[model samples]
Target: MIQLYDSFHQASKDLYYSLTQAGFQGPVVVINDDGFLPEGVTSAYSYYCQMETGQGRSLYFNQLQVPPFWEITGTNGDGEVWDYSQRKAKIFYAEPKHLRRIKNVDWFGPNEKVRFTDHYNRFGWLFARTYFNAEQKVTSRIYFNQAKQEVLVENFMTGDIQLNWQGKVYFFDNRVELFRHYFAEMGWELSEIWYNSLSTPFFLSYNSPEAGQDILFWQEGIQEDIPGNMKVMLNSSHVRTQRVLVQQRQVYQKMMDILPEEQKAKIAYLGYIYPSLRENAGRKEILILTNSDQIEKLEELTQALPDFHFHIGALTEMSQRLMAFEAKSNITLYPNISQKQLQRLFQECDIYLDINHSGEVMDAVRKAFEQNMVILAFEQTIHNRDLIPAAHRFDASQPTDMVMALAGFAASYPQMVALQREETSNESVTGYQQLLGKEER
Candidate 1:
């Protein structure tokens, strides 16, 4: 077996270990750079013809760039004709932890966890390779097509059902009809589905609902408009003419307003989350969650809380604005941190400050809320007011009101703790139940 990769990244190293266990003893070939090569069996390949001209592996037939399926005809340093067609190999990219013994016939879980590096070009090539490698036990890519015997479940993204590693499959699905159709297409039975929050709207044009009975949808509150991504996903011709919109305030509430009363019975205000039990005791730190929409206010918030230490967690870095606030000594900026590192911040900080929210509650805010951190989301992001308790929210429209509110909360830090401790986890009240048949057994 032969392995190929580029760069010194975690993915490349993972591939090496996984490939070694899969009995690929051939020297690994790196495309260009050799700096991060494996000690014993790794070599770098650069194309240079004996003539003054240069050549690349992909550059075929008069230097026209073609797929890897095409071969490069040339003589190497050994002066032998290189016949690429003679080499027939299957490309495989198994996660390091998921590799089975070589030639062993055993089932493994899917690629639910993505552990690739920030090198998009390199990882993009890897994705392309592994996509075609779906046939030869590409756990994730192949499972979608070959999950007939495996049980599939639907829940929120984070609340994805757990699976037994050998064979059991627990899939997390967002859309009901779309998943049902996709499973049917794949020749798999749509066995079981479990939904948590009524986060996204189940769009419809009429008072009709989905026809699937082998499912459980725990309904939460509703809002007026559907998320952009959900709208695009539900744009199929079957759902297109049947879809409707609600002008109400909440997403699930809108669904409740339109749907028949009996249909609304499947939904209630109960949802469940495996809460983050990490404890953040007695830390006088504040966190600001920001993205492209909130950078201007992030700068202002840093100025507003000058005496306090602040950690700003941003997914993207708006260089100028970030740098300006980062100049402050009391402010510590964390950009593009891993989920694990971010979780550390969630468990360490005393308060979370979500100043500007577009609409949805971001994962950071949601997870932080679950951690029972003192969340102080601004009132302009009105949806946040619903997500967090009233005591933790300040009016974004009124700067003086926000300052005074923050000061009060800072003064009464112990009271904030007492409230979070007393209040039940937000998901418990969300209506979730097992779906039995018409017998109710």
Candidate 2:
């Protein structure tokens, strides 16, 4: 009896049917965070990776629980090799405190609670390894086939699934799809997947009807415009396209308030002037603090902006570790910082550089503007208008071009900084209203 654990609804259903059809005489358990356990199952567990069991590993009403599980035998979504030993350690140490464990095997009960992570990666391999390491027992590997547009079918315990491309297999995490696509391009068949919260409906909030409808629009839009039969397994709950624009305005305005009375009244260029003074030519090291998702793209820009120093910051400890591994010699890489420290940094920078964005970028801009910093941005970028004030705009395509432009505004840096503060503090709710209008209409 092979135990196949999965979480996605439609894909899980497909795997269950496929496994049963393959003549596996065991139960397929579908565990989820919403306290959802399939009916007629023996018991529920928190996660598949932890070694908690029925007796000691109890949740609400005596349910058994396990730690989080992830598949680690293949390349990861970020196009990097996964550290399996570290991943196994993460599996063991990261488990919830309530569950107990012996050597392996986790257990839960009828009324016990379950746990789930926001993302699932490497779950298939993790479970397979867990069962294999424990009692030499194994189940199967199920996944999607990109080229054929089908799922790969195979049983891992007997190594039956090895290299044999059968029918289509479900991919629980789209990141896994990314991993598979990247590795498959290199002629490697990466097995295993971690299914996340796609089996059931998941949105940012239950109350926003407009947000829900807008997501539907992006989903359909992606399907129609984007080629290929690739399925969109998940999407953000709300449309965050204009948030950066609003923040840029707020930050620029706030900067003006913090300026000296005379500095505030300086009669200089009002909108998007390039720096000219030797002292104000962004000579000070400028850091663009940002999250993990933007790091890859930002790294490319840094290569072009050789005159400007660059730094990277990610929101998570995991990302920090990854950044440490990827950090360059001259570039500073810091772990996540508090909002207070971030605002202080903004004040210290001569030039506040921000990526044109839809969501969190606005928050960063608003913080910078409140500290009275001069901002630089691309003129024609899509979200540039929403995230960056027109007064600070610059040509973003080439860094050499921007440096030449900045040399002109160096002498007028004070004026630009003051303008930023004034723009950020203006209380007109026009931008917010515009954002609301999009979702509302």
Candidate 3:
């Protein structure tokens, strides 16, 4: 059986599903340090144990008590190929069915840092990071010299290699277009690509399969702006990587729940999108500070609430478009509010409504909370769970409930005021401290 290196996340589910959809039938194993998994999962999950193959047509990998080396074996002639030099052992068979359960054996080795199998798909073969030492940060250095079967054992390994010398290598890229170009240039063989959201040189390469059989392995840290089904090919294999993936897994069904087919027929009968009773002008002073992409949506909202004046701040051309629309709608636009000016606006406004959750917005809200200002926001996600109090949350879909909630908040001025201040003053996380210890810098 080909060993697939999967990180414990939502995408693993997607990848497993994709493979199953492609008619590959086999037991899927999900492993993690914590061993916590979702309900209805059947795979074997374990923690704190080493893996290996046991005796008889069985696959065995043993975890030793101490470091330096471990042993794995496949009896019944599966083939015991060991690269003692690289400290990697491979059990290969022409047919996958001949192998038995892939047993986990305990192992402790000072020299074993990273190890995993090479995978060759319809796209191509790629080596993925299966297991690595957390304390040992391998340098950007890979050492190999005109060899194909032998891998050099090293403490620090790095470099840009098309393939590793131990018959394992990877051609990793983020850009889809660039990947497609390169794949064509390299004669179109099976290869896997690694992608992340660094906004660096990564995240632009993809090789669109001519067969239209692209399978999406959802990676961690992907945002909502990228649609759930955007990269997912229909009737394909899939996996989910993190908690956010759980949210996406249900987004389509949840949206359907929000707007049923019957409601669609009556949308036009309601005349205006929103009712007039609650659409009164100037009911509350709304301070809207957005970074530009959301300006036009805010403008439409301004049209709906004609009485309430708008003070908009944006940073892009699209934000400028919001400015033009606001002018036509007779609303005020603060095109570029400085940080100090924004703080003052927060102080003066009756309600603070940002587009969605944001780190900078959270800081602003914290300031507002400290000043005893009322803040309204959509349902919280993991990112802002710690920042928001239960009392200040408003539903995104239920405008009537949201308005009622806001009104209730307004009537109860200074409600939880002390609590809000206390929460704001609580110690918070700092990225600088997270990346580097206070003493290191």
Candidate 4:
């Protein structure tokens, strides 16, 4: 069995975890090589680079090997490499500070024009380099082997790829063809294929005759109509796709409502089996993880609920305006919080306030959801609408409504959580086992 995906985003990661929890064993192959992936997930670039398993050191900002005069400054999200006063490059991390390993670096030329980006593997090797044109458009990308030799070259303008393997040279018209070649070279039996995308992975499964059964774990959202590709997978008998599992309950219902009865037979609703980390202590402790102090109506909410304790934490130091909240008897502040502290907060707190502005820090909304916290937010301040149910969201102007909802939740915590879980559609291992039609190994 093989698990194929175009990219390893949050949805893809959830699918991987869900499959593993259901006792499905397979090799995961990602088409895009962002250089930062969870353990055991391999990318096409990694295979071309001939990266050995468990090899190479972790690449850090200080060891980036920049110019002698360049200095590196760290921030909450990423690091900046500066040449004297001018910015030279921006360093990104898979997990800032905690992982401390370099994911990629964007280099700037004269007038701070983007020249190219160097993608580094977590194993600390430069595996790929993508160049940009004067107009800031991607021109080409070069994939490197462990010996630092060019193994493949991709042209963005023409959608072509040139591969140099062993002593032979091969050319492909597009990425799909290049990926198909990679699978062929790997010499693995494509008997059972599990994929999560309706694009490249769908095409590969549709075309590969060796694949006996194809299960598509659809992660994308659908609106009034089902996607054309998904329709093809469900309606067409010529394709190998045997089942289409929708990860979101709402999307699955929409698809079911639109498709015919025969097509509906091939579809099922599936959700991630998130590990429960929360304990219902009836403490009424609320947690807010933020990168900015622009928490909408924070003072109003805090003042409205005198009995509830608000715990606000940040990866960086808090400003004076935010620090003033420390004077509140029911409010606590955690500046420059550590991972251990964050874990403790997630466990101790039963409710999470998704009211902070600016970008989310450390995927906080998902973390809170996984911790089984009752997440509430103002519609404007909510970062991820998918995880936050519509009923839990309120208007920014109606602070009283939010306060009333919080009071109600605090009054009946367990009942509210049960309703929240039902809306979120958190699944179990048994659901996956039935979908896969196999017992746990």
Candidate 5:
């Protein structure tokens, strides 16, 4: 059995976790090698060259090797490299410094355009470099080995891949062919395949050796009609797909509404088994994680609901504007919050206020939802609308309504938690066992 995916993103991670929790023991293969995949996840690029598994080392800004006399400037989320009395040389983007591991570094040329980007593996090694043209378009990417030697080159201009494995040189017309070559080289039997994408993964499965039952775990949103590839998997006699598991309930409902009765049997709604970390003891505490001070109507909300204690935290130090909120009797500020403190805040706080204007800090909204916190957000400041329900969202001018709703939720905390649990729709192990046709041991 194998799990094939285009990338090891958050959705892919969730799906992989779900499958593993459901007693799946298979080699997970990712097509796109970002070089920063978490432990146990293998990429095609890494497998072809037989690269060593990542060591899970922490990549810090100071540890990065730079040119002589280059200066390193550290910020809240990322670091910058500047040439001696010259323009910006490179930008290092990564997690918070405390949990820092370099994801990638963008190199700038003399012309100030990004010439290439060095993608670093979590094992503290440079695994790939992506080159960009003058217009900032991707031209080619070169994958490297632990010896820093080029092992594979992918040309975006012509959609060709060149692999120099062992002593042989091979060329593929497209990524699918390259992936097929990889599967052949690995010599793994295509017994049972689980895929989470409809694009490349679908094609690879459809064109596979046809001995295995393909299960499509649909994780993407349905913007319009059912995807063409999914339709093929559901209706095509040539395809080996036996079932289509929709991860989102709304998307599953949409598929049910569109497909006929016969096709509906092949589809089912499945959700990840999210961890229960919520301890809503009716404390009436609200948590807000932000990197910036542009929290909309924060003062109004704090002033309106004096009974509800607001705990605002940032990974970095708060500015004077944000610090002014400390004067409020109901507000508590946490600057430079550690991982332990953050987890405690998530567990203690019953509500998460997504009214901060900025990029989300460390996927806080999702974490809040997983922690089973009641999420309330204003339309203008909401970062992720998918997790927060429609009834909980309010306009910027409707702070009074939001305050009232918070009060109502606080008054009926147990009922609010029940609703949240129902809305989560996390599937149990039995549902997954039934889907995979496995009997409980």
Candidate 6:
């Protein structure tokens, strides 16, 4: 019998389907944390990277398909082998005819119930295996995704790796071309490069020196203009590391004014992303930076302002209900737009309505301000409120009030231009580079 343990769904499901379609027969054990997976899925997705060759003939691997680590030849009569077997990801044979049922057991041994708590962080799995030149056991920091019955296993751990690759010019280039260039320089044939949005990690392969670098992902405070994918960095097998970077920045100077002892290091005078501003080519465009959470607010605002062109830059997929608003000619909703496309929108729009969800100092709002677009925020934090002008700020708790204020502002076009003047500009994030490069005189 053959079995596969898949820890993630995105690309893995496609892999499974392709395998089954290709006539490969095997029982698959997958992460069932959600408890909603169809029959045939078992929750124990940990990589028992080692095999007990004395008792069993087959060696097992967890999620993503990998190059094999070990092999065995037919045992001799004297408990010795005359031949060697090739190691591979496929589990050619196994001890069990049927998929093993997980019985409320911990990886160490069996129990009456599942040992892992719902909120358990994954690095706690010491039983999980990491393979180096010789099999070396290392702990991983992976998140348990309950809904999809998924976790990233093996080389798919996502984290950020910053290699000073001949300075930062390579950072601005395309992924495929840059990788091709790297391989060309190294004189290696590039067989495959795989990365997906979900739990499956990315792999950059060549030889020992290029393989095990860590990839960093900024989780919490990301004040940069970047693509939807670049926001996260995951751990990969060829790549190394287990933690995600949660970068936080204090945007308002008033925070220091309130603090008796100002932590200069704590706050960012200018946030990430060098601003590229444009003079108001003002198209009477009103932009709203939003995500899935604020559907109702977005709908109401769009319906209320039928006369105005409302451009909703959806950072992520919102409900179909809000998506339905595109039926109205006045509302334009953009889902998962590219960084360049978003920048063009910023340059063209006249007013930026940042009725964003709570706990966000949205980089979009800042980017719009750098372009001298009128900034309006609702239910923003004190830190964000201080950054936005009083004339433009409104209480999101009262959606009607927010709409009315916007309506009033729209009626008074001259007032909008005056508010832009009242708001002061500081040295952009580009200038911060000089400050960072400066030496104490």
Clashes, model 6 = 15
lDDT of each: 0.40, 0.35, 0.35, 0.85, 0.81, 0.41
Candidate 5 residue-wise lDDT, 1-441, digit = tens:
889988888788888887788888878899887766666888678876455454547467667888788888777567778787666645565554446567688888877889999898767788889999989999999988877788899999999999988888999998989988877777877867789888888888888766778888888888768888877777876678878988888888988998888889999988887666656777789999888898999988998899999999998889999999899889999999888999888888888999989888878888887877888899998887767777778999979989898878757777766666566557777888886768422
Kindly provide the TM-score of model 6 when superposed on the true structure, using C-alpha atoms.
Answer: 0.36
lDDT of 1 at 265: 51
Tens digits of lDDT, candidate 1, 197-227: 1222122111124332222122223346444
**Candidate 6, residues 1-441: lDDT per residue as tens digits?**
122222434234433443343343444444323222334433332221111111211122222222354332221110111113422222211111112111111121122222221221122122222222212222222232323222333232223211223233222132223333444554532332222222322323222144333322221223333223332232122333332222223424443444234222322333233233565554668877664445336677777877779888754565787688789899888876556767777777888777656433245655676676777766542234434667676666777876776676646655665565445322333343353323211
Q: TM-score, each model?
A: 0.40, 0.30, 0.30, 0.91, 0.91, 0.36
Top candidate on lDDT is 4
lDDT of 3 at 254: 44
With a 3 Å backbone cut-off (N, CA, C), the pairs that clash in candidate 4 are: none
* C-alpha lDDT of residue 177 in model 2: 31
For model 3, residues 1-441, the per-residue Cα lDDT tens digits are 111223334345444443333334433333221222333332111210111111113222232122344444554233333445543544333222123233222122446533443321111111112333545543432222222222222222432224232354444332233233334543533333322222211222222333221122324323444343433322223322111111122333343354446422211110001101111122356676554444223544455555555555543233444556655554666654556667666656655554433333324554454444555566642123334566656555554544555555444645544344344323222322332123320
Question: What C-alpha root-mean-square deviation, in Å, does candidate 2 show against the real structure?
Answer: 20.7
Model 3 lDDT, full chain set: 0.35
Error of 5 at 277 (Å): 2.6
Off by over 4 Å in 2: 1-283, 293-307, 317-330, 337-344, 356-362, 379-387, 398-401, 421-441
Candidate 3, superposed: residue stretches over 4 Å from native: 1-284, 295-309, 315-321, 328-330, 356-362, 380-383, 416-441
**Deviation in Å, model 6, residue 129 alpha carbon:** 16
Model 5 lowest lDDT segment of ten: 89-98
